[model samples]
Structure formats: structure tokens, C-alpha cells
Target: MNYQLSLTVAICFGLLVLLGYFLPDFDLLILLRAEILRWAAILSGVAMFVGIISLLKVHFNKFMDQKSNWGYSLVLVLTFLITFGAGVFSFIFPQAEGLVDFMFRYVQVPVESTLAALLAVLLLVAGMRMVRYRRDWTTWLFLAISLIMLIGLVTIEAPIPDVFPFLRDWLLTVPVVAGARGILIGLALGAIITGLRIFTGADQPYGE
Candidate 1:
């Protein structure tokens, strides 16, 4: 019975998806496409909720055992609960409460910014150490680019000749932006393919 139901649903979905592409003249196909997208969003939200539940469970266990770094888990749980409560109350009240917004703006933002700054420092230190150890052309190139980027971002005015700021702008706009965009596109495509594969029963992670 389960097999038959699954097969039927798959067949129907495939036919509707194909129809939307093949018969671009039909308005009903467009509606079907929208419906498909709506359901996809709903399912994705549910999946995200499931993931959060799993993460909370793991962290709660760690906290209960008083594991090393359990303080971080405590912070995580506290933050999650506070944010959840704020969201629920915000929904009920419909007015932006000062305390909730303050917590979100001051507490959350500073913590996030501090963490980001720490990571950036760690990355820079690691890169410097690598350059010290390897002293290869690749490491040299990485250090050069990183330093140029840091300088460009920090300096109010370009240190180089007027033409050099233009050059730096070009390098940042062209290569840096293009590489970042390409990586993002590749990651998004990979995620979509993996999701579809799982949905189609081609990749099973649950050992079914």
C-alpha cells in the first residue's frame, strides 16, 4: 500500500512538472507550478524545525552531562529560548517590545560580531603562520591578495597613485566578486541536486 501510494504521488508530480515546462501556453500549468513552490517552501520550513529540534536535543544532553564547553551549550539554549519567547510574544502583541528588540540588537549582534572578529583574526594568524612555514609561491600569492584586500578595506584613501585605487577597485569588483558569486552558485546548485536526489529516493540517509 505504501509503495503504491508513493509511486502514484511521484507519477503525478512528474507529470505536472513536465506539463508546466512542455505546455507553456496553459495558465493552469503556471498555477500548478506556483502550488508546487508553495508546498516546497512549507516542507522546507518543517525540515528546518526538525533540524532545530535535533540540535537542541544534542546540546541539552551535553549540558546535562556537564561536558567540556557545556557553558557554550547553556548560552545556546538560553539564546534560543529567549529568541523563541520574544518571537511568540511579538506575534501575540504585535507591538515591538523594547526589551526584546534590545536583546536582539545589543546582545545578539555584539555576540555575533565578536565571534566573527575572532574568526577573522584566527584566519589571519593561520595564514601568516602558513606563509612563515611554507614560503611557497601559492602562499605568497594568498598573503599578497589578503593584505591588499585588508588594506583596500581599511584605508580611507588609496595609498597607491590615483590609478592604483582604480586598479584595486577593478580587482575587487571583477575577480573577487566573480569568484564569490561562482562559489555561491555552485553551492546552491549542489544543495538543490542533493535535495532532489534524496526526495527521489536516490540517496537515503535514514537507512531505509
Candidate 2:
């Protein structure tokens, strides 16, 4: 009974949202849809806050238990609290704007850039290993594509009418776009199927 009620509510809201999008001339439907969306956003924010609390509780428990590598959890909690406090202070104080900018520019950006550089180096190493050990046509093709893309990106400042730029543009516009669109279509179809399963009670994600 409870499951049926939940499924009915989900299906009704889903259909209403779809109808609102397709038949925009209905003022009442549009107004109701807007109200539903507003509530959805509020609920999403609440869910996020709940998730953060749950995460902090789990980590705090681990720290209290003195589990192996619990120091990392302690550090995570400290950093999370510090960042949150900093954000709140910055919001409340006009003078703290500089502190926010300094944290983002000096601390966050450099950390992110370092991680990205490390990832690029790891990818290159993996590609080299694949070429050296596998020696298969597919491995060679993957390595070739990676090298071409890297070269194209690095040589972007080369004079116009250059081969690297031309190849880069072609690869980006054709193969990359086609692959991305195919992945997006697959994801959309999967979501639709999952939604249908829930609507029909074929998949009872909520519980038995």
C-alpha cells in the first residue's frame, strides 16, 4: 500500500512535469509545475545537508575508534569545518572577500592543478606501458590517438594553417562529438528505462 502510494505520486509528478514542458499554454499546469520544481530544489538541498552530516558522523566515529589511517579522516573533518567556517565568515563580512579569493586562488587552484598534472603523467605512463607490453593494433591505435591529441593541444599556438591545428579541429569536431553524443544518448535511454521500471514496480529500490 505504501509502495503503491509512493509509485502513484512519482508517476503523477513525472507525467505532470512532462506535460508542463510539452504543453506550455496551460497556465495552471505551469504554475503547479513551478511549485513542484521549487519544492524539489529545497528537498535536494536538504538531502545534501543530510548527506554531509552522515559523512561527518561516519568519519568522526572512525576517528574516535582510532582505526588505521584515521588521521586522514581527522584531517578531512578539520578541513571541511575550516572551509565551511571560512565561507560563512566571508559571506557575513565584506572585508573577508580577500580571504576567500586568496584561499581559492592560492590554495585550491594550485592543489587542483597539481592533481591534474599528476593525472596527465599517469595517463602517459599507462599509454606507454600499453604500447610496450600489449603491442596490439588496438593498443597502438589508442596510443596514437592520445599522442595526436596531446600534440594538437600543446601546439595550439603554432601559426595558422598548421597540420597539428587542422588535425585537432577535425578530431574534436567529428570523432569526439560523435562519441560524446552516443554516450549521452545511451545515458538518457538508461535513465528512461530505470524510471519506467520504477513506475511499473519492476524495480523496488525503496525496499521490499
User: For model 1, how big is the CA root-mean-square deviation?
Assistant: 4.4
lDDT of 1: 0.80
Model 2: lDDT of residue 155: 39
Instruction: Report how far off residue 57 is in candidate 2 (Å).
Output: 1.0
Best by lDDT: 2
CA lDDT of each prediction against the hidden true structure: 0.80, 0.85
**Which window of ten consecutive residues has the lowest lDDT sum in model 2?**
155-164
Cα lDDT tens digits, model 1, 6-122, are: 655665776787689889899999789779878979999999999999999989999999999999999889889988898788778877666588887898799889998899789
Clashing pairs in 2: none
lDDT of 2 by residue, 1-208 (tens): 8888887887888788878988999998899899899999999999999999999999999999999999999997998888888888989997886776788899889999999889978987887787778987888777677767777788336554467667888999999999999999999999999988877667778852
TM-score, one value per model: 0.66, 0.76
Which candidate number maximizes TM-score?
2
lDDT of 2: 0.85
lDDT of 2 at 3: 80
* Poorly placed runs, candidate 2 (over 4 Å): 87-106, 129-135, 151-170
